[model samples]
Target: MALRLLLDSADPSAWAEWLPTGLFRGVTTNPTLLRRAAQPCNLEHLAELTARALELGAEELHLQAWGADLLGCGRALAQLAPGRIWVKLPITRAGAAAARALIAEGCPVTFTACYEPAQVLLAVALGADYIAPYLGRISDLGRDGHANLTRMQRIVESVRRVDPDGPGDRPDASPPLRLLVASLRSPNDLALLAAEGLDTFTISPDIATALFAVEPTLAAAAQFERDAEDT
Candidate 1:
């Protein structure tokens, strides 16, 4: 499972459509995605969504904590499924504080909204299970998102070498702190980033749809069906 993929969406409809395909390892969501899906950002709603995702075979569900009490929200979110839930927090001071507390409790934490290369250091220090960097958003900021992400990957590997006992170690130990790339605008981003050794990604449903929409593949599949019917 070097190349891991997760559905980056909040809509249950999206989960119902894609999760059964088994193309996605899990799903990731945030406050913005929740609003876009017309869902309230609260523990009650999140709990329901978590149940649905897990029921649909989501091995991991990332739910971002929100509002003033980040720590409180994070704590509650982690309780949704314990080992299966990965509480997402932004790469800010306050978010870091909440993340640190959550990490100490052995909660799976993922640092989201990452833009800079140095932020990987913080994630490594906190022993987060994942750090999500928005690729398209970085490019929107007029920077080379691909290059920035490459650097983040390097830093993660470098730290792993320094501290072999760190995240993503032996199977019996804790899970690795993978770089979960997000905000992908196109399917090609996956290939480009994966080529750079960034294996984990969370793509929107649109991108997931696009991945299966290759004209040649569709034509071949149609031909195969026709041939089978004729025979």
Candidate 2:
């Protein structure tokens, strides 16, 4: 599968602006991003935020269900649109139970806050649809983020071998469990991770912008266009 880029933002306006570019597949947001984006973090607004995501052409929506509302958020998301909203749950014991409950109720999950490859194994065991490891944060903790990141493919394959009923099983029937990485330092990190064969990324808007913006490359394109016009 091709690499899928998702914008990490809480503001619906950002989704409206960026999803139209055809590069972003969706938006991944939690209450923290909402606070940063200056939007109200309330339960009443959940449906509206989700609807806004879909109206703006986002094919997928990753919403965080934290602080005693994992099941509540799953129920709320189910009311919005089917199969598009993947609730973000931390990989705690509660989170694992909540994920299983939510999946039983038809809500998929993205297990977040992973820092190690072993954590990835546990998430797969819980039947998470996606696992998001914080690359920059892992590096901040002085861990070998690249080693963990590069090991994801091998880890995932190993998990699938042991559990055929797990996510990523029977590729013809279902899309594999995706490793949706986040908190990358820059566009350069995105490039390196992509080179490592990581297929999905949830990046900040600045990194997303930088990914397409190269002054030297744009200048060359401009010169080529000018010469063609003159010719």
Candidate 3:
């Protein structure tokens, strides 16, 4: 399939306006973005936001666990209606446990905050459909985030099973783990990942908007309109 462009925003208006464009694969949101969008309902506000996405015919609706502890995560998970929610989890001991429990129940999970091959491998072992490595966050620490993701991609590809000692299931041919690179900083960051052949990304609303408004593309469209008018 083509590269999946997803909006990583939680605003209800953003979803209502953007989903109709048919450019976004779906929406992905966290506690921070949702709070910025509106008063955080201890995540209770997400139900209406999700309903809006579904009403607009979204393909996927990804949400993050509001709390750090397993209980808190579970509480956050309970508020969401379960059609297409992929709960994002940390790689902590409690988080991994929650992810495995959810995975076993046939629920989709995206293991977030990953920064290394080990974490990526762990998510793959848990059968997480998506593993998100925070890109700009890693760069903030003066580390090479792209290099780290390269290593993660290698590790994900080498794994022969979804869960080696746990789920004990054979990995599918479609690549057991899908990388959803997060925390994008700019349009160049999006171009960088696309040039490197990465397929999925969770981009901020501003960046996603900027992506469709590049100078060259806009210029070409204007020229096409002018030529058609002359014709």
Show where candidate 1 strays beyond 4 Å.
Answer: 168-173
Better of 2 and 3 by TM-score: 2
In model 3, the worst 10-residue window by lDDT is 166-175
List per-prediction Cα lDDT, in the order shown: 0.92, 0.82, 0.77
TM-score for every candidate vs. truth?
Answer: 0.95, 0.91, 0.86
Name the runs in model 2 displaced over 4 angstroms: 162-166, 171-174
Model 2 C-alpha RMSD vs. true structure (Å) is 2.0
Q: Which stretches of candidate 3 lie over 4 Å from their true place?
A: 68-79, 160-175
lDDT of 2 by residue, 1-231 (tens): 688989999977778778898889999998899999888776568778888888889898888886676777666766566788888888888888888888777677888998888888777666677899999999999888877888986788776788777666666534567789999888888888788888899988888778769999999999999999999
List of clashing residue pairs for candidate 3: none
Q: Pick the candidate with the highest TM-score.
A: 1
**lDDT of the structure predicted as candidate 1:** 0.92
TM-score ranking, high to low: 1, 2, 3
TM-score of predicted structure 3: 0.86
User: In terms of lDDT, which candidate is stronger, 1 or 3?
Assistant: 1
- Estimate, for each residue in 152-205, the C-alpha lDDT of model 1 and write its tens digit: 999988987888777667666677678999999999999999999999999999
lDDT of 3 by residue, 1-231 (tens): 268877888888888778888888888888788778874745556777777887887888888875547545654564476647878877888888888777766677888888776888788667788889998998888999877777777676567434353432434322367889899899888787667767789888788778788889999999999999999
